[model samples]
Target: MTTSVSIFPIRHHGPGSARSLEHALSQLNPDVVLVEGPSDADPVLPFLTQRGMKPPVALLGYVNDDPARAAFWPFAAFSPEFVAFRWAARASARFMDLPASATLAGERRNDDHDDLHSDPLRVLAEAAGHADFERWWETLVEARGDDFEVFDAINEAMRAVRADAPPPTGREAQREAHMRQTIRAALKDGAVRVAVVCGAWHAPMLDVDAFKAKDDAALLKGLPKVKVTLTWVPWTHGRLSVGSGYGAGVRSPGYYDHLFTTRSAVTERWFARVARLLRAERLEASSASVIEATRLANTLAALRGRALPGLDELNEAALSVFGWDSDLPLRLIERELVVGEALGEVPADVPTVPLAQDLAKLQKFLRLKVQPEQIDLTLDVRTDNDLARSVLFHRLNLLGVPWAKERYAGGRGTFKEAWALAWKPEFSVQLVEASRSGQTVHDAATATATDAARTAGTLAELTTLLESVRYADLSGATPVALAALDARAAGSADVSDLLEALPPLARLARYGDVRGRGSESNTLAGGTFRTLLTRAGVGLPLAGVGLADDAAATLRGKVNGADAAVRLLDDPDALRGWQAALTRLADRDDAHPLLNGDAVRRLRDASVLDGPEVERRLGLALSSSVPLEVTAWLDGFLDDSGAFLIHDAGLLALLDDWMTGLDATVFQETLPLLRRVFSRFGKPERRAIGETLRGGGAAGRGVRRELDEDRAMLAVPVVLRLLGVTT
Candidate 1:
C-alpha cells in the first residue's frame, strides 16, 4: 500500500479536533475522504448533508428480522465525524469499515476476545498533571488555534502508550485487515490525496502492516451472515450525556455545541444564555448578574490555569452569582444550558418500518412530540383527544417503552390523568424492536398482552393484565385475554382472588359499555363477573375461617371489594347470595372476629340489618370476648369512621362499658389497635367522639332534648326543601 494517505485520529466529540480536521482538509484538498463508520451506511452519506438535516441524529443499523442485534453511530453537532461528513458531502466521500451485519455477528461470538487497550486520554491526562482528561484537553488543545500538528502529537502519544499492549485478537485482527484492504483499494483508484478520520485508538493500528492480505481474507472468509437494515432516527441531549448509559456519550453536549457553534466569546454567550434561563424560571438574573457571572467564570479559568472557561467554571460562576447557597440553581443550568433538551429530526420522507410510521402518525395526531425534556400533562379522560393520548401512553408502557410515566397528583379531579413524559434515544430502539409483534402500536401492544395472558400462571396476574388491556383499549387481544381469564378463574380456588377479580369486570359490565368496550366485551366481562361472583359466594364463608391477622386483613379488603362488586352488578340474585354468605360468616362462632365484624358493618351499611341487630351484635361481642378479640371486632367495626356511634347511643354506651370494665393491662394491650382504628377516622368524626367522651352529644350538642312535636313537624318541609327533596 502507498504512504499517500494521512489519518487524522480524533476524540469523538472534540470541538478542537473538528476545527483542526476542517482546516487540514482545506489545505490538503483531498479528492476522497474516508470516515470510520458502518460501511453499510455509505448510501446515506448524501442524506447527511441534505438541507434541514441536523446532527444529534444517528445512523442505526440492525438485523432486519432480529432487531435485537443492532448498533448506533450517533453524531452531535460538535462531533468530528459530523464535521467530516459535512466537508465530505461538499467534496464527495465514502465510509470505509466493516459492515454492520458482520460487526453484529462478530460481536455475538467475540465476547471472549477481551480488548486490552486502555483509555489513551487517561494516560495523557496523568502526564499533564490533570485529574480529568476533558479539562486538560480543553485547556491545551481546544482553547488553542486549530493546528493540524496537534492530531499528529495525539496519534504519537496514543501509539507510545499502546506500544506494550497485547496484540489484536482474532476478530480485531480481521477488522484491521479489512480496513487496510479498503485503504489499498482507494489508493489504487488513482486518488492523489486521501484523508481518513478515525477514532484515536485505531489510528496506530491502521498505520502498521501487522497482517498480510491473504491471511486477513481467509480469517474474514465464511463469516456468518444475517439480514440487516439501516435507517436514520432522532436522538436527544439527555441521552447524549454519559450518565444516560451510552458508553461514548459526552458529559455535556450543550457545552460542546456552544463551543462548536461560537468558537469565540464563549464565556459572554454562555452567561447570557444562563441569565435568560434563570429569568424564564422567575429567578432574578439581570444583565448585572450576567456581567458578574462572566467575570467569575473567567476568574475561575485563571485559577484553574485553563486557557478559557469550560463547563465546570461556567456552572460554578452561575451558582455563585445567582446567590444560591445550594446547587439547585446550578442543576437547572445543567439541564437547560449545560446538557440542553434538544431532540434531533429525521426527514419526513425517510424510510422506516410500518410500525414506526404508524406511531409517528399517532403522536402527530395527538400533538405529542417526542422530546428530551420531561413534560407534565394533565388529561381529562372526558375529552376525546386526552383519552386517546392516555391510551397510547399506557400501551407504550406495557410494551416496555417508558416514554411516559403515570404520576399520582392531587386535586386534578377524578377523571384527570397525570403523566410525566420524557423521550430517550433508546425509546426508538425499543419501538423498532417492538415492531416484531405487529405493524401498529395497538396491535403490537395487544399481541404482547396476549402472550403475557397465555403465559400467566395465576388468576391475579391474568386479571391485572385484563384490566390493563381494557384500559389500553386493545380490542384485538380481547379473546385471548378473555380465554386466559376464564381458564385461570375456573381453576382458582382462592375466594379472595375471585372476589378481587369481580369488581373490574362488574364495572365493565355496568359502565364500560358506555365507554366504548363494545357489546361483545361487555357481555363477556359480565359473564366472567357472574361466574367468579358465584364461585366467591360459595367459598367466602370457608375462606373466613382460621384466617391469621394478615390473611384476615386481606380477606376484609376482599369483602369490601365484594360489597362494591355486588352493588355495581345490581343483580338481585347475586346480591342476595353474597349477603347470605356474609350473614353466615357473621353468625359462625369459628370465624375470625375481624371477618365477623366486617360482615356485620357491611350488613348495616347495606341497611339489611336494623339498629337493634347491630346493637345486639355489639353487646354480644363486648361482653363475651377476650380483650384482643374485642379490639379486633372493634377494629373491623370502627374501620374508618365514628359516625356509627353518633346515631346509636345504646351502641356508644356499650363501647363505654366495655372499655371501663377492662383493667389497666388490658387497656394498654388494646391501645395500639384502638389507635390504628381511630387513625382511620376523619377529623370531624374524631372531634365528635371526643366531645361525646366529655358528655357533649354529637358535635357538642347536649343530650337530645325531647323534640317539640309542633316545632319538629313544621321543620320537616323546610329540611326537605333545603336537602333538594321537595315534599
Candidate 2:
C-alpha cells in the first residue's frame, strides 16, 4: 500500500508550532514518523517515555569514535524534539529519527560547517515586521498564542527564506532525500504512509517526488555514522540561552523560560517572587518595594502600549524594587526563576554504562536526601564496607556532586577518602549536563581536572583548583594534564599557594593506589605532596589560611598553618623563595629576624650549611661589591621580595657601616641618608634603635645592612663591577 506522508518542519517547544504539530500528527494518522537525531538515540525512546522523566532535559549524546576529540548535543526539557517524541510515543506511531545512526561515519567526516552558520547578524529595518528575527518570531508566532496561526506563519516565513536564501548545496535536498528513503524503506516492507518532523528550515525539502527521482542509496553516499548513546540530562538556562548562537530569540533564556512556562509571568509576578525568595532566604527584601517597582514597570509598559511588561520593564522593576542597583538580583534572580528546579530522570532500564547508571541512581537518591550547605562526610570504601555509600559519593561527583570539603581528612587510598557532600539539585543537573560533553566520568570531569592545572598564583586560586580537580584524574587524566601544575608550584613564590595545590593532587594520586597503578606514583606523589611543606621551611611566617573558600579544607590551616614556616624548616620551595623574601625584611628590621630564623632552622633541619662555601662567597663579595656581579657578590643577600634592605645583620652593624659607609666621597652622600632614616623610623621603633646600638651581628652583614642599603646597593655593585676585582 502506498500512502502520501506529511513531513512537518517545526520548532520544538514552540507553543504555536507544537500545537500545530500535535494536531497534524493526530489528524494525519501516519504509519511511521521520522524525527531528526543521531539515530543511535533511537533505542532510548522507550526510556525517555518513563513517567518520572521530565522535559527541559537534554538528550546527552556522545561519540567515542574518537575519544581524544569529542563534541556534544544538548537538548532541554522545553525542547520541541522532546515534545514530539512524547507525542509520537503516545500515538504509538512507529517513530524513528532519520539522521546518520549505528554507523557514525559522519562523526569522522568533517563537513566544514563552522563557516556556514556564520552568516551575518545584519538586520534590515522593519522588513521582518519586528526589530529582529526574535521580536518578529515572538510577535507573529509566540505572543499571538495561536498555534494554528503560529504554524501557518512559521511555514510561510520559512518558505520565503527557503526560496530566497537557499542553502548552497541545495535548500530542499535533505528532506527530499529523507522522504525518498522513507518511501523506499516502506516499499521494501510493503507498508505505506509516513510523516517526518524536522526543523522549519527543512520544510521545503519534504516533498517525496522531488528526491524519489534521485538514487536514494547514492544520495546517502559517504554519509557517515557512528555509535552513540543519548540520555536525558537536565540543562541550565544558560545552555538554552541564545544571545549569540544557532537558536533564535533566546537573548535571555532565563526570561524566556519564565515567559514560556507561565503565559505571561508579568513584572509584578517576577518581582514578587524575587522579593519573596530573598526574604525567605533572609536576604532582606520587602513585598511593598517589589510592588512599587512592578507599578513602575507597568507604567513603562503602558507608555509603550504593551499589555504586560517586557524584559526591560521587568529588569528595571527588579532593580528599582528589591535589587540594590548594583548586581545582587541581576546575579541571582535569573538562576532562581529561569532555570528553576530542572530535574531529569533516567529509567532503570535505560541502556547505559554501569558507571553512568550508578551515577544516575546516586543523583536520584541524593535529590531526596538534602543536607545543609556546610558539611563533612566520611566514607569508608574498605574491603568489608557497605557498597552503597562508596558508590553513592563517586556517583554524585560523577554527576558533578556538590560537597563541602572536610575539616580534616584522615588516612589514604580510595578506601579512606574524606568526602563532604552537599546534594544540591543544580549540582546534579550540572553533572548530568556534563555527560553530554564527555561520554564517561573522566570526560565530564574536565572542568575540575583541567582547572587543577592552573597558573597557581595565590593560595586562593591553588586551593580552589585543588578542590575542583579532586577525583577527576581517577581515569588516568593526570599525565601531561598535571605536569605543568607540579612545575608551577615549585616556581611559585607564594609559599601558601604551593602548599595548597599539593595535598589535593597527592590525595588523587594516592587514590590511584586503590586502582593499582604503582609505588613510583606514591614517591612522585609524596615528593610532590611534601614539596610545598619542604619549601615552607622553618620560621617562614605562617601565611594565614590563604583563603577559607572551603571551611573544611581551611580547617587544617587554622591548626597548623601558622607554624608552616616555623616547622617545615627544610622544604626547598620555601627556603628558595621566602629565604630571599626574608633577606629584604631588614630595614623594617622585623624581617631579618624572620629570615635569619628560617636560615638557622634550615641549617639545623638539614644538619648542613655551606660554612666554607659561605666564607668563600663572603670574600668574593667584599673584594668586588658592584651593581653587577662584582658588586652584587660583595654585599649581603637582598632581593625586591619586600622592602629595601641594609645588608648588615644587626641594626648597630648597619649603623656602623652607615657611619663608616662607602668612602669619604660616598660617606658624604650616605651619611645624610643614614641620618634621615635614623630620624624617620630610627626613633619611633625602639627595636630598630636597640639593634643599631648593638654590636656587629653577622659577618655576612658586609658594608650594607637592613639599616643603610638602598639605591646605593645597585650603585655600589655597578662601581665594583667596573673595578674588575676578583669578586
Candidate 3:
C-alpha cells in the first residue's frame, strides 16, 4: 500500500526554485503533489487557477471564531508554491500542512519559540560575501541554475545551519509534526511517486522515522479546535518587500516574476521591461539604452563570475546608461519595474470570512472599491451619501483598521472632512479580528468606542474619543462616553485639561442636532461646561501670571478653546458669567499680558466694550509705565488680526501717541512686537496705517469722544445688576 514520495524543498519566493520544481515535477511526473499550507485552503485551490486569477495573492487562513489569530501564506507569480500549485492542480495535489484551527490553537497555548540570536540566512549570506541575504540568494541560488540538483545543495546547506540552531518548539513543533503526518498519509495512498514541496528549512525533518507517527498523533491530540475558513485575496508587488510583514517576502517580486515566466534571453527581456517603465515616466530610456544596459549588465555579471545578471548588476547598468549620476532616477526604476505596482485578483467564489464578505458588499454598495493606491476622499459630512462614507472610514478606524486617516482641512469647516484612504491587503486581517466585536461595522465601532471610553484616563482623551464615536455614527456609544466624561470631569482640576475637553463636547452639542442625535448630549455638555468654566474662572488669572512665551502659546490655545465653548454654548447666562471672568482678568495688572490682551479682544469681539472704551484701555496699557504688557498685548491681541487698526481711529491715535512719545531705547525694545502686530495687517491696511502715522490725516482731529460721567453714572445701577455686584 506504501507509495514512493520524493521530498523536494524550496525557498518560498525564489524564481529559480519554482523553475527547478517545475522541471522535477515534469521529469518525475509524480502521481500527487503536496504543498505546505493550511489544509483548509485545499478546497479553494481550484479557484486559484480559474480564468483571470492572478499571482501576488495569498491564502488567508484564520479561525472563523477568532480571526485575530491568523497567518498568511502569500504567493507571487515567482513563488515556488504558486508554480507548484499550478503543477499540482494538473496532478490533483493537496495541501499537507496543519489546519488553521490547530495552528491558531497551538499559538494560543504559548507554544511558540523565537530565537533572537541565530539566523541561518545571515550565516549563509555572510559566507557568500554578501551583506544582504536576498542578494546572496539571488546571485548564488536563483541566478545560476533552475534544476533539481540546486535544491540538493540548498538542502545540505540548510541541514548544516539547522544543526547550529535551536530546535522548533510549541506551535512550530506541532506544525512540523502535522506536516510529517500528512506526508505519511500521502505515501500510504500507494502513489507511484509523491513530490513533497515544503520550505527548505523543514526538508531534513521530513524523514518519517525522525518523528514517530504516534508521537505526531499525540502532539495533535486534544488540541482545542475552532471552525476555520480559507480564502484567496489580492496582494500587491510593493507589499512583496519584507516591510509588508510577509514572512518570506521577496525583495523584488516583479523581477522574479519575469525570471519565472521568461524562457530565453531573460536579461534582454528584463531590460526591455525597464525601458518601458522609464519611457512611461517620461525619462530617457531608448532601445539603444536597453541594448547598452544589457551588455553592461552581462559584462558586470561575467566579471563577477555570475551565470546571469542579477538586480544589482542591472541597476548599475541602468544608472550608467540612463544618464543619472545620482540614484534618484534609478529609484524610480526600482519602484515601478523591480517592486512594481501591479495588484493580483482572485475568483469571487473563494470563501471569505463573514465580516470581510460583508465589508466587500458594503464597499460595492457604497461605490467605494478598494484601491491599492492611496487616494484622498473629501467628504461634506452634511450630505447623506458623503456622510456615510466618512462614517465608514471612522468606524474602521475605531476597530483599529486604518484604511483612512482624517486630515486637517484648515478652516472652521465643521461639516467638511478629508480622509486619505489606501486599502491594503492586510486590512482584511484587521477586519477579521474586529469581527469578534460585532457583526456589522456600525455595531463593532460602537463596541470599540464604548470599550475605549471605559478605559480612557483623561477627560480630553475621552472627549476626543466621543467625537470619533459621533463622527462614526456609533450613537450607541454616546451614552457610555457621556457617562465616562461626567465621571472624569468631576475629578479633574487642571484648567488646561478642561479647556482641551470643552470644544469637541461643545461642537457635538451644537451640531449633533443636524445629525439628529445631540439634544441629550448637548444638555450633558452644557452641564460639564458650566462646572469646568466655574473652576477655570477661579484659576485663570492666577495661572496666567508670569508666563513664558511657550506657556503663553499653550495658554493661547486654551483661551481659543474657551472662546469656542462660548460660541457653542449659545446660553446667555453662561456667556455673561464667562465674560465677567474674562473682564476681571483683563483688569488685573499682574495677569499674563498675553492673557490680558486675549481677554480684552474676546470681550471686544463679544461686543462687551464700546469702541472708545477699548481705545482708552489700550492707551492706558501702552503707556511707558507698562512696557512688558505692551509687547505681550501686541503679540496676543494684534497677532491674529489688524482689522481694528484700519477702522478704529481712537485705537489708532492711542497707538500713534504712545509710539511718538517712546524714547529710542523703548522703540528698540518693543520693535519685535511692533513688527509682529504690523505683519498681520494687510498691505492696504498697513499702507493706510503708515500714511496716518506720517501725518497724512487731518491735523488735530483728536478723535476722543468725551465721556459724560453723569450720564454713565445714571446707568451704574443697571451695570451693577448685570455684574451681580449690587452695593
Candidate 4:
C-alpha cells in the first residue's frame, strides 16, 4: 500500500522539454498526472483535446466581479504544460497549483529577496560557464535526444543547486507548499504511482515526505479568495516571447516549435523554409543557398562542440550564406521563422459570453481572420461584406474593445474606410463585461453608445458619439444620440464648442447619403449641422474680438475647421452663411489681426472678394498694424502655403513693396515671424516664389517676359483640330 511519486520538472515553454516530457510520460504511464496551471481551469481541460483547439492559446482566469483582475496560463504547442495536458487527457490529470482565486486576490508578501530561489536556473547556468540560462538549457537538454535520463540529470542538478539556495518564502513558498499538499491528496486517493510535472526550480521541493502536511496547511491558511471564472482564449506566438514581457516566455517560440515538430533534418527543413520565405519576398534565395546555409550551420555547431545547430548558429549561417549586407533580412527571417505571428483558435463549443459568440459567428460569416499581427484593412462600404466589416469594427470600438483602430484610408471618398486591426487576449474580458448591456455585439454596442450620449457633458462629445453611431449604423442608438446632441447644442453658449461640433455633424450628414439612409438620417444630422453653424456664426465676431495671441490662434483653428466642414457639406446656403460671418470678422478693426487677416484670406479663397479688395485689406493691415501684428496678419493671410503668393502677382508685389519700406529695426524684429510664415510652404512653391521675386518682382517679371507671335500662332491649327473645328 505504498505510494510512489515521480516529479518531472521542465522549462515552461521549451520544445526540447516538451518532447522529452511526452516521451517520458509514454513510458511511465502514471495513475494520475498533474501539471502546473491554475487549478480552477480544470473544468476547461477537456476542451484542450477538442479537434478545433489549437495551441498558442491560454487559460484565462479572472475575478468574476472585476474582469480586469485576471491572469493567463499560456500554452504553445511546444510548451511542456501543453504536452502534459494532452497526455493527461487519456489518463487521469489535474492542475496542481494555487487556484486563480488566491493568485488574483493580490495578497502575496514581498519579503523574499533570495536571488537563487528567484532564478535558480541563472545560478546553475552561471555555474556552467554560460551567461544566458536559455542558451545553456537549450545546449544541454533541448538539443539532445529525447531520453528520460535527462530528467534524472535535471533533478540531480536542481538538488545540488538548491542545497545552497535560500528556502522559498512569500508567494514562492506558498506555491510549493500547495504543490506538496496536492501530491499528498493524490497519494491518499489510492493512487499508487503519481506523476507531478512542474517548473524545474520547484521540482526539488515537491516530495510529500520532505515537508510536513500541517505546516503546508498552515501556510495555505487565511489565503484570500474571490469568485473566479475560467475560459480558453486565443494566444499568439509573439506573445510567447520574452520580449513581450511574459516572465516564463522563451526567446524564440517559433524556433522551439521547429525543434519539437521537426524530428529529423531540423537544420535542413528550417533553412529550406527560410529560403522559401526569402523567395516569396522577391529576395534572392536559391536552392544552392539553402544547401550552403545548412552546411554552414552544421559546421558551426560542430565547431562549437554542440549536438545540433541552435537558433544562433542557424541565423549566423543564414546571414553568411544569404550575403546580406544589413540585418534587415535577418530580422525578417526572425519575425517570420524565429518569433512567428501565428494566432491560435478556440472551438466553437467552448464556454464564452453571448456577445463573444455572436462576434465569432460574424467573423466567420464575413471571412475575417482574427489575427495577432496588425493588418491593414480597407473596407469598400459599397460592397455588402466590407460594409458589414466596418459596422462590426465600429461597434466593437464602442464597447471599449479596440480590436480594430480606425486609420486614415487616404482620398478614397466616403465609400472606403481603413482600419488597423490586431486582436488582443484581454478583449475577451472586455467582451464579458460588455455582455451586461446586451446578448449580441450590435445590441450591446448600441446600448453603450446610447448611454454615453445621454451622459455626455458637452455638445462636442454628443456630436462625436453621434458620428460613431452613424458609422456603426446603430439605428437603435441614433435617435437617442441625436436628441441628446440637440439638447446640448441648445444649452451650449461657447461658440468654439459650437464650431467644434459642426464638423462631425456635417460629416454625419454627408455620410448618410453614402450609407443610403434616406432622408431621416440626413434630416437629423443636416438640421443639427445648420443649427450649430447658425449659432457659431452669430457669436464668431464677439469670440474673435479682444483675443490674445494664443487665444486668437486657437479661435482661428476653429474657424478653419468650420470653413472646411462647410465646404465638405457642399451646401450653398451653409457656404453663404459662413462667408458672411468671415466678412464681419474681417471688417472689425478691434478683432485680433490674425483673425482679421485669416477672415480676409477665407473670403478671397471663396471668391467673395475681388483682387483689388484683397490688395486694399493687405495694404491697410501692413500700414496700420505694429511689427508683431503685421507678422500675424501676414501669417494668417498666407496660411500655410505660398501658392497664393506664387500665383497672385499684385499680392506678391504689394508684400515685396511693404517689406522694402520697413525700417531696419522693424525688419529685424519681424524677420523671425516672416521666416515662420514662409517656412510652412513646400520647397517647390517657395523656390517658385523666390524666382518670381528674384526676376525683379512678380509685376516686373511679367512685363519682362517676351513672347514670340510666330511660336504662339504655330499652335492655333493644332488646337483647332483638337477642338474638332474645320478651320
Give the winner by lDDT: 4
Model 1 Cα lDDT, one tens digit per residue, 373-468:
889998887889999998998898878889999898552225677899988877777888899988999999999998999998776677667767
Q: The CA-based lDDT of model 2 is what?
A: 0.48
Q: Return the TM-score for each candidate structure.
A: 0.80, 0.58, 0.73, 0.89
The regions of model 3 sitting more than 4 angstroms off are 39-46, 63-66, 106-126, 129-146, 163-174, 209-230, 245-247, 262-292, 323-326, 380-387, 410-416, 446-494, 505-556, 564-577, 586-727
Q: Model 2: runs farther than 4 Å from truth?
A: 1-8, 12-33, 63-71, 92-103, 106-138, 142-146, 166-176, 183-195, 213-216, 227-234, 242-250, 263-268, 339-343, 359-727
All models: lDDT?
0.79, 0.48, 0.77, 0.85
lDDT of 2 at 439: 54
The best candidate in terms of TM-score: 4
> TM-score rank, highest first?
4, 1, 3, 2
Candidate 3 vs. true structure, TM-score:
0.73
The model with the greater TM-score, 1 or 3, is: 1
Model 4 residue 564 lDDT score: 89
Off by over 4 Å in 4: 107-123, 126-135, 142-149, 152-168, 374-377, 407-413, 545-552, 623-626, 657-672, 696-727
lDDT of 4 by residue, 1-727 (tens): 7777989978788776787788889988889998987777789899999999998899988787887777788999999898988998888889989999989898434433554554566566787776545557667765555456778788888988788877877788888898988898888888887989998888999988888999999999999899988999999889898899776667788888888888899999998899888889888999999999999999998898776777889889989988568776698889988999888999989998889999999999999888888889888888999988998998999999999998887742468888999988778889988988999988999899999998998888888888888878888998899788878988999999999898888877776636676458767889889989988998999899888999999999989889988998899998899899999999999889999999999999889999999999999998865889889998899998888787788888788878867888989998999999999999998888888877844544652344568879999999999999995
Candidate 3 local lDDT, residue 216? 86
| Ten contiguous residues minimizing lDDT sum, candidate 4 | 107-116
- Global local distance difference test of model 4: 0.85
